[model samples]
Target chain A: MKLTTTKRLERLNERYANGDISRRSFLTLTAAAAAATGLSMPWMGRALAAVSEVRFDGWGGVVQEAIDKYAFQPYTAKSKVKVVQGTFGDENEIITKIKTSKPGDFQIVHSSGVNYYIKYVNGGFNSEINEANIPNMANVLTAMIEPFRKITPKLSAVPYDYGTTGIAYNNKVISPEEAKEKGANLLTDTKYAGKIGGYADMTTRVWYAALQTKQDPNSIQDMDAVWAKVRETRDLAKKFWSSGAELMDLLSRNEIVVTDAWSGRVAALQQQGQPIGYLDPAGSYAWMEDMLVLKGSPMAECEELINFMLDPATSIAVAEGQNYPPSLDPTKVKLTDKIAALPAFDPTGSMKSLTFADPLYWAKNEDAWTKQWDRVSKGA
Target chain B: MTKGWKLYDQRLAWILVAPVLLLLILLLLLPIAMMTVYTFFTFVTAGVESAVLTFDNWKEFLTDSYYHGFLWKTVRVGAITAVICAILGYFPAYFIWATTFRHKWLLLLLLIVPFWISFTIRTFSWIHILGEQGLINVVLIRLGVISEPLPMLYTEGAVIMGLLHFLLPYMILNVYVSLESIDRTLIAAARSMGCTSAQAFREVTLPLSMPGLGAGLLLCFVLAAGSYVTPQLLGGSRDALFGNLIYDTIMGQLNWPMGATLSIVLFVLLGAAAAAYSRYMGLSQIMKGLSA
Candidate 1:
């Protein structure tokens, strides 16, 4: 396709931001150029008018920041394809659009866990991937790919990174022995009352609840059974955090002694000298985030982007930057001592005991479980 | 009344009003129309639709006592917020209106300055003042006045506090307009009739300002009822109001049909109540009161 007016302007704007062109020159040239070329501004600026622009729907906070820094910036610098990052990771918003929006509207999506894969993509809103285009697939850990394949059966998504839900405690406050004793129950124990933090996400919280109740984490069909254990620890919580940033803020302020957190987050904080400790507990959850290219989207380009993400150096940068272990094989990229010490960076270690979330179960019973949790929403 | 201009001149009037009407149709009417259709359809995961016309979504919502409890909880939250906003707003709005000081506009400006900042940011600001190891707790701890941090942030009280902070400005503005609209002559006349200051306020000023108070009550309650942010940010698990329920259903469960059903239900319930209220007050009277 010929370069649309929108694409030209976007490139021009990007050049301006990069200081490649002076403002006066850009204004003067674009004005003269538009008049000469019979191209206009207002109408062409709309997203629908642009073709070959890869739409990225990514995570918020650290994940987004890291992706921008380590992946998007470098990829855009090298690749011919123009990527326009839009507001994303809002599953509901995306789900609504899945039906109404035309094909190729969104080219790439990044979200954690396989729930969406089972619930949405498996249900039919998906596209196939050519692994050959993503040559770096050879470097991707088999463990990482297994979860996606297990959930969707035909997961068009490539595993980008993975992490686990565990007890993140301040080593200075709780000490190693106390944390080991409390294990997954550290956040629920009365001894840590008013100092424990909880997350509101049903997937992680339900898994935590399952473990707390001594139920088989793999089979969490009974909503009542889950809520029963959740209720036992409800009063022990200081607050239910809404975001990763909020939970991190709670810890940074010395507000929470122990909180349910992603091991990757704790590792990130520790590197920043926060003295955060992550314990696997007797039972916990491991989750992975994937990059999906929708059917009728610019697949070849997206496959290239995923390949770039899976590249050995890019993968290592993402692992270090986001503090989540890359799905790529560790042998391909060397890790610093501090990063290697993070359990998420070495998934094959003690994480065998932790149960990976049952995505199929969650996809089926999300509504019922949501109501059950709503019954005890205020764990205060 | 003008000789040249016809009251229902289609060409001229429509030309002028077309933009607004078109905007309303596209932005408001279109979405509602779509939602009405979605309300009857079945939503499966993955954004797939069955095209099967069904009332199961509506039936499920109506039959479930769990959802009814959410409705009641939302009402309670709205009532509490509206009442508190009215009470708190009255003193300040009255103070501003009664004052003949040269800087009265400055006081009003100060009242509205907080609104200039983003509402979500304002809601988040409460966390520092109310969290366990936040400003208040840190101060108290340093002073050795408390051994443990108080649980001030994540409670029903904090949610109400946030709602009041946001809704109070509207309430004050409404009440201030009514108070300013009250004829000073009436109060003077009441005083001359052997009435005390309290009696003048009760008989003259209070009655005249009822419209503003009424408008404020309705506005605050409606806004607070639909608020999802303040409660989520401030109130822990205990305060998942109706908006929260809708959000979770749509986003978490990915159940659009049920979500649309809830939306329609909320819209109908609020609309019906507002209609009843307008009928009681007379729509003209309420509008006049708001303007006043």
Candidate 2:
């Protein structure tokens, strides 16, 4: 195919963005082509200027604080490109926002892993990332990236960190021994009625419910039993928190004795001497978070930012600060003792110890299950 | 020119109202029209609706008892809240209107103070006052008056309490403005005709203030019924209003077609209520209350 001047320039730009060609080589080639064609490119300046700011939305609180402090601040200092930040209490809330907005209005999201990745892909909001651009994916665990890759052959997101939605109990009220003994059933224990709490999310509610009903979350045979268990807990719960900050406040203030909580927030509470005990029950729900690049985003800048975030030192700092295990392969990259000791950390890097939701299995039932959960949660 | 520019001339009136009319069409009518169109679209999945025309959304809504139950509950709660506001609000408004104090404006200024703070923060403040470890519970526990903390924070009662806190000011203002517009000499005239103060108030003051009270009730009802935040923050899961239902459908379920259907249902329901009030009592009273 004969390449038009515009197509040639576009291909050259993509190559440069993907780090396939060096700047000097690209400039030399472009100058030669310009001289041969006897024309100057008018769109080059506008294209370069378009990527000055990259919009990012994430779950705000300590997690975003860590990212902003360790990754975004240093990346901004180095690249001179701003990372504008927004926050959402729920992933669905952000998806709704994106749906209402025009493309490019939201560029990058701190997306919940493969399950949400499927939603974005289904909604046609995903962008194909040139793996060549984000070189630091080498250090990331293949176990984490493979899930995202399964949904889209060309990945739109890079897995960043992992944690469990474990049971967090007020140690003053419930003994650690009792928490371990009861396991996931503690959430539905009548003894903690009117004092229990849980995450107000369908996946978390259903996952814990599956465990309580002695069914596999990824492939539940008895959804009726699972939902019954959810309603049982809902009856017992004092409140179902929607955000990490609310979770912390509920735990710290002694408003709730027990709840399924984010492992990192539980760790933060423990560090603060809040008498919080975290127990990742057998078959606890393990989930991963990813730095997702949306369609119409400035690809080069986003890839550069992800690369900066994945740098070992930066990633470790963020992991330590956020109290979640980084997605860095322990064998490939040396991690700090703090990150290794964090909740849900798999030192062997095989990721066999943690159980994750089957994205396809869950995605199939997401619409129906979510609607029912919303109803059951409201005293259906 | 004078003949053409008569005050009630249709062309002059249209020109005068055109900017606001255009703004109303752009901001209000256009969004509602779009939402109405969306209600007919097919919901493919979460965040993936199709424009293929279908009546599935409306059919589901019409057949569903769940939506009906929530709508009934919202209206019930809103009515209870408005009635409570009118009862609780009237006395304070009467006190302000009949006060012998020279600085009457100070009382009205105090009424406006709550609006200075963010509404969400104000709603959230109730948590600190009503939670298990909150002020009332802690104080009661310390005083040896209560053995355990009451479950005051997350209940239907808490939702009503929150609505009262938010809607009371509107009621007070409406009542106060109506009371202020009353002719004082009429009360004096009734008293001079051998009527007791109470009888005078019943004959003159109370009858005159009914419009304000009615307007306040309507305003409170509409605002409370459409509320989303107060219930989400202060009420239990079961205390979710119709607005919360619409929010979950749109924001949680990502079912925009159904969400829009729910939304249009609420819009029509609330619009019908305002229309009924206007048809009976006239909307001018509400305008007078709001302006004052």
Candidate 3:
């Protein structure tokens, strides 16, 4: 029996050497052999126990602060899992890190909703979440959960926070009525050219254009027209901003009377006593930040962290502190009367009116948009 | 007759050059080689898939009119900025070098003062000086210069101004070195031959300083070509140059291969310019002129 087994093993090894067996199967066989040889011993367990660390990569600012206070500290205290934090500029940086660096370099990453959809869902960089392990996920609102479910049926991401793209105007320079009027007629009106500003991001710009034009953000398949409109708008635009700070600078300096801005950024500006007011006149595009477990992560602790973040109190604190709408059940947490009144976090609504950003659309049409924008901007 | 002396000199030369040569190969040549190879491949959207050998990225750049325009614009802007710097820098450099010892150090110190602050901070400071309600506009309006604020910050004029501000010193320093190295006797000889002061300066000083001017122009051009922050902050959306395009490709679009291709293109153009200058005007002579 031993001789027959040896011969069979030798034949299998020959097949593996000849590239018949895949690396996955080879790894499985190796693991089985290690188990058979008694190598899954006490030392391995002790070593793993000693190195109980989880790295969380995310964007900095209020979101990071909320994570530190509500999730990172509490989770570390309860589970003794050391949380190491790294900050990234945007999704591209995170993608670059994942592609170039070692696996599990960032076990968990906080990503924008569209980025999660494109990179995690469409690009297959994320693993399916085991919902049972994330008990606190039950607290997330149905409306917020619905979009992710519809878009990525695989449940690859856990929704974290949300914000809207809207017009932020300097109240001192532009009246509320003027701002609203401009917001209402932004797409069709060529009169306000050279005074308006917007983000440099193609996805955000496209969504804004669609909303202003009253086109269905999801249904409008042809982007060439959209690119043309955006290019026209760019010519009219005084500047294209890359960051929140730049927008604020433009507003403060009165270089721009009104501009498209993120809600959190506008809120931060308001807190700083800038005479800025944000309004979502034509129904703003909503982006849900998601915490996705990278593939090949140390899953157990990552799941624990996600569950911890999903808790109602934690979610509420993150939302209020970060100036972003939390994905958790709204009824369970107390919100400022002003925050509660915001359309995004309306507790009584069965469905929130939101234009979901599609990354696939952006990816497919980016080249065309870039070329058009280049032409328009250069006055070619 | 002197084998030991010859061996000693050879060893000394090798010892002196080895460290710098190794550093150059490691830091510059290796990265350029990798970038050259990467420019030919297409980066897969998914991380799981490996890059394949292809000419699609290069082909796209070659065929695309937008990128071609960007390339030409970059060269034009660089050339314009270099010329402006050369013109503006000549007088300051000559003035500083021509002055006596007492004023020379003070003038030199004044030239170097801007380098004390960070580049980003300096670039941002321009906004305060040139924005719609900024210092320049406000003062001008107060002085009844114009009824409305001038379009200053996000314009090509602002980009050129920022480039000039940043590169002016480099030109001055280079030209100064060249001016300082001229044989005082050459000027005396020209004057003794009955030439006017202006004529002697035009003939002798200017010709002797051509190498320095060329070197400074080349440096200014290359720096202006690769500059990102000043142009993005100061120029209009359409005014974004080649560097900005590379940034957009890499960071905005997540297309590394395209970014690599754009970078290689920039590198080749800049490298060719440098090589041509070095071939026509000796590199050592240029350096000597700069240091003069």
Candidate 4:
């Protein structure tokens, strides 16, 4: 079909906007055409040289700082590719960007495990990595990489960091031993009823409840029993929390004697001399943040960036700086004893203790669970 | 000559309203229409493809007893909050309107000062004030009022308290306008006619302020019904509201069709309530009350 001038211009605009053709790449294409038309210049060749720039989207603040210090600056220095930073408040926002924005807007995104599997893969928003370009993928521990491979054999995501969901409590009233002994039931116990709180996230809470009841976390059909148990426990709970600050405040005021808390926050509080302690029950939920390439990204640049981040030394730096466990082989890198002793980096015992959450299960049961959660929350 | 002036006046009225009408159609009406259309479609999976049309989402919502419970709870909370706001706001607004003092503006500013800070920060501050280790517990323990911290932060009461903090100003502002517009001479005439102070207030001021009270109540109700943050941060697991459900469906679940369905339902319910209110009390009265 013959295209009109306006249609040709529109196609060019679309290509440029989608980053299918960069400004330099577009100019190069035009210059080559001009050369064929006998209108070439030496200055045009210099301007047409490809400019290397990579954009990485991740959670902002200190996490971005870690990325800049360890990954961005080093990668840029080595490859001469400038790294642009994009920020997202949460996993949902990242997924939304991937779904709605033009594909090449983000070359790499830091996302939670559930989001990577459910949104990126299921939605067809991410492309499988070209394994050859990502040499460091071979360096990632088999156990760490196996989880992503099993979910999607083509490997759309690379593991970055892993953390477990566990209980945090005011040590003054509830002893660490007592919290350990009671396990997940501590939330439902009458003694601490109305004094207990936890994170408001359904996936974590449902998994915790299921694990407490000796049910499979990955099984969607089992969630009803879990929800019922959560409802019973929630009846005793003083509140369900949405943020670390709120959890800290609740712990401080003695409004909550116990709560489900992130390990990092619990550790920070313990360091501050607040009588706070964390417990990993036999079967708690664990999460890993992953990096995935958007489907239409510049595959070469994206693969290079992922490979750079997966380097043992780079991953180690990120782990140490962010206080989260790197998914790469820990033994490959040298570390100070203090940094080595960090809970996230040395998260051996807790890793086995956790029942890894299944994003598929959540995708299936989310509607019913959310509606029921709202009903329960409103005291209906 | 007068006919030309009348024609100009009519044209000026249309000119004034045209922009707002166009804006409302583009921003509000168009989105609502799209949302209604999408609600019929079924999302295959979270963030996956959606089909053209189906009744599955609406059917699921209607058939489920759980959703009905959520609906009832939303209305219950909205009604209770509105009532409380109206009662609490009426006195303060009336006082502000009746008083003639240099400090009135200062008092008004003090009432509105909370609006300057972020809602999330303010909600989080309550945790420090109410937690076991928080200020209240520490102060109470130090004063020997209690040995242990009282559980306060994550209860239904905390959610209501937070909602009150947010909705109270709207209530007061609405009622104050109506109260201020009332003529002082009418009140003086009532008093001069030997009507007792309480009698004059009940007969004259109270009747005149009904329109404002009704408007303030409706505003508070609508806002409270749609609130997600206060309940999410303050209320326990069973405290998630209709707004929270919408948030989870759209963001957490990635079930846009269901979220859209819930939103449309919420809007229709709200529209019906507003229509009912207008039937009992003219919409014009509410507008006047709000302006006052």
Reference-based TM-score of each model: 0.86, 0.95, 0.85, 0.84
Candidate 1 interface RMSD value: 3.7
Flag clash pairs in model 1: A120-B46, A377-B237, A378-B237, A378-B238
Candidate 2 segments whose C-alpha is farther than 4 A from its true place: A1-46, B1-4
Total backbone collisions, model 3: 2
- In model 2, the Cα lDDT at residue A164 comes to 95
Query: Would you list the clashing residue pairs of candidate 2?
Result: none
- Whose DockQ is greatest here? 2
Chain A TM-score compared with the true chain A, each model in order:
0.79, 0.92, 0.79, 0.77
Best-matching candidate per lDDT: 2
- Clash totals for all models, in order? 4, 0, 2, 19
lDDT, residue B238, candidate 4: 64
lDDT of each: 0.76, 0.92, 0.74, 0.74
DockQ value of candidate 2: 0.82
Q: Each candidate's iRMS in angstroms? A: 3.7, 0.6, 3.7, 3.3
| lDDT head-to-head 2 vs 3, winner | 2
Off by over 4 Å in 4: A1-65, A72-90, A100-107, A150-154, A169-187, A216-225, A244-257, A270-274, A295-304, A331-340, A344-380, B1-15, B102-104, B280-292
- Assess candidate 4 and give its TM-score to the true structure: 0.84
- Fraction of the reference Cα-Cα interface contacts (below 8 Å) that each candidate reproduces: 0.62, 0.83, 0.54, 0.62
Work out the iRMS of candidate 4. Answer: 3.3
Off by over 4 Å in 3: A1-57, A61-89, A121-133, A146-156, A178-184, A187-191, A271-273, A295-301, A331-338, A348-350, A358-380, B1-16, B43-50, B285-292
